[model samples]
Target: MIEQSRLVTPVLGFAGFSGSGKTTLLEAVIPHLKSSGLRVGLMKHSHHDIEPDKPTKDSYRLRYAGSDQLLLATSKRHMLFFEYRDNEERDPQLRECLAQLDHSRLDIVLVEGFRNETLPKIEIHRPSYVKPTLFPHDPHIIAVAYDQKPDALDEFNLPSLDLNQPSDIAGFIKHWLANAPESEKYLAYELKL
Candidate 1:
């Protein structure tokens, strides 16, 4: 039997400060997207150091032997490890990493950070954090997911979504994707531009 190819996969992003509800919103939306017959890919950006290779793992040994990147897969799981030089930044180029996704099988890629990228994003916010609203200044911010009413936010003209309502948020994403321009559809929107 021939394998079915995926339709266009739009990229969505979630951006917020530390302790904001970015992950919380993702936890809610991913399952809903999957249920709707869409295959989803996820990428998270982190500033901290990450050790993808444990000292005893074969992948680690390969990296220690001076391999630049290592790929490990089993029947159930797959992981990639890229060795970095000391003092180098840990994160890889977002676009380059995203390009490695199997677009043939994915309908969407939900990115959890990289606030500066030009993709449409839901800015998770909490009033107590007192951070400036991203939507006011950044046209790329498509919505705001907040935990409480932001009294200082009445002047902004963006959609304000409830952080706790994952179903509703999922509905919003579905609607947006359904209506998005054909040329604009796909994962890594900003990268395309």
Candidate 2:
């Protein structure tokens, strides 16, 4: 059997501070998208240094010995370990990471963080934080999720999703995916109402 690649995978982003339900929303949304028969890919961004391989492990030792990238695989799972070179000046761009995926097989890409990146995002806000809303000047903010009614803001026209009900939020995302222009390829696999 020959494998075919998908033409496009619309990227969706979620951004918020720690403990603001960003991961919670993703946990609910990913299963919903998969149950609808769409192959979903996820990418999480973190500013702190990450160690996927432990220091005492062989992979970690090999990496320290100077391998640029490491591929570890078992019968059921695989992981790619990448080490940045000292002379490397630039970091990978969001699109570059997206391009590295086998998009031909995926229906969508859900990203967490990268708030400053130019991409469509759903901002998760907590009323208690008392922070400024992201939609006022960010055209890329497609929606907002909040625990309570947000104070009136005239600059943004985007809809708001309730953070209390994960199902409702998932439903809203499903609706958006169904109506979005890039949804053509996955329309056939869309969930029936």
Query: lDDT for every model?
Result: 0.77, 0.74
Each candidate structure's TM-score, on Cα atoms with residue i matched to residue i, is 0.85, 0.82
lDDT of 2 at 43: 85
Worst 10 residues of 2 by lDDT: 184-193
User: Candidate 2's error at 70, in angstroms?
Assistant: 1.4
lDDT of 1 by residue, 91-159 (tens): 666666676677777777888999888778888999888787777777777778898866656777677
Q: Count the backbone clashes (under 3 Å) in each candidate.
A: 0, 2
Q: Which residue pairs of candidate 1 clash?
A: none
Candidate 2 off by > 4 Å: 1-7, 87-92, 153-155, 183-193
